[model samples]
Target: MKKLMISVVAAALVLTMAGCGSKDSGGTKVKFATDAAYAPMEYMDKDKVAGFDIDFLAEVMKEAGLAYSVTNTGWDTMLTSVQQGKEYQAGISSVSITDERKQTYDYTAPYFESTNMILVKEGSPIKSALDLKDKKVAVQISTTADTLMTKIMGGDNKSLKRMDNNTLALMELESNGVDAVVADIAIIREYVKNNPNKKFVSIADAKNFESEYYGILLPKGSDLKAKLDPAIKKVIENGKYATVYKKWFGQEPDTKKLLDQK
Candidate 1:
């Protein structure tokens, strides 16, 4: 009887260990982080997260057979949060892929192409980049737009107004707190489209503004990149990418034009 009881206890222990292992390996659940203040890319629609990147990533995750959840983190901390793995595994907030950032994070292939644009109140007389000289330009802090503005207008230029997010920067422009806002062209266009009463106009200078490519960001050497990269390519090849692009931008993606730009 003693031997039988010992054998039963051993079997129970094996079962418990197996159950724990199964739970850990049962499914792929990636925690995704984003700053939802940038519309048409990733933004809060009502109480839920919805936008181009959200929809596009949902398809990519499905293709990769991974379950995922998104958390709205502050833009300043979003990248670091993914890098630290304290709260998220990946970030996708129209994050531009740049050599400087590559050292800190692994990124999926370029998912979207973007360019900088100058936004001004309608009939404000700021028709082009030259008009921005000595103007108070508002930009989201730490974004590529801010970097561009600092480079163009000088870092210590008192005309530069840094805001926490693009929406706030636009508000500053509407209230005449700033003469203009410099930001991603798609973001500016989306904002103007959604707020018909706001009276905003955008100016693009292809010669002056370099096009940027956005990608999904993960911690350095993250295995999620292996799964996500292939899925991104598959979506582009299968028309799903264009479908999502059209849903958000109101026109089908010119795949050849976008891919060739890189």
Candidate 2:
């Protein structure tokens, strides 16, 4: 359900920001902005940006015959900068495609399937989305998880704590400040795998949490969409995508189903 987004109308951004892209033998590299906070998708590995989305983007750009670079500029900066289409040409922070966001930007064909999942301390009574109705919950602000939880908890419910990032949201749950944290499955699964001693459990409620797809965020009418789509289709079909998927997830991706999605 989420990893990226910030509610900003992103008017013309300042073009003064330094540290942009460099040229390559092919041409100037496509500049990408990402919030290096979403793991198994995109996150900081020390000083370097590393994860599934980063590795996947390498394949995508290779297929498209382009050079590219990604920067860890945080979610809000990434969203607004990419929206302006000045500082960065595209964004790939596990950003989910939704109707509300479609009004602001165009997106490449979906590359990943995801859904919100609940991360609760082991032995918690919560089992589904409905179970959190009266419970304290934390979610990253302005994400699909935030949007959906707002509806479930009622618009102004104080029980829903919206944090600046999922790392903070999960921390709140770990500290018992909240009963659960709602975030994308990739994030939840990665956290659980790395923190086995945390004694956390993940629950997938298929009824309340529906399928969502992640796409490369682009500014409206951007030319990259034309170049990226075919490359995405080719990589997904020709087995390149599955290799990247299995590298991060340790399992084969459902390319058949992924291709069938709009």
The number of the candidate with the highest lDDT is 2
The global Cα lDDT (0 to 1) of model 2 is 0.85
Local accuracy by lDDT, each model: 0.76, 0.85
The candidate 1 region of ten consecutive residues with least summed lDDT is 1-10
Instruction: Flag clash pairs in model 2.
Output: none
Report the lDDT tens digits of candidate 1 across residue range 18-38.
011112324756778776767
Instruction: Give the per-residue lDDT digits (tens) of candidate 2, residues 1-262.
Output: 5534565543322221213223242667788988777888877777678889888888878778787778787777888888899979998888888887899899999999999999999999999999999999999887889988988998799999999788899999988999999999998999999999989999999999999999999999999999999989999999999999999999999998889988
lDDT of residue 151 for candidate 1: 81
Give stretches of model 2 more than 4 Å off: 3-26
Q: Superpose all Cα atoms of candidate 1 onto the true structure and report the RMSD in Å to 1 decimal.
A: 13.2
| Model 1 TM-score (2 dp) | 0.85
Give the number of the best model, judged by TM-score. 2
The 10 consecutive residues of candidate 2 with the worst lDDT sum are 12-21
| lDDT against true structure, model 1 | 0.76
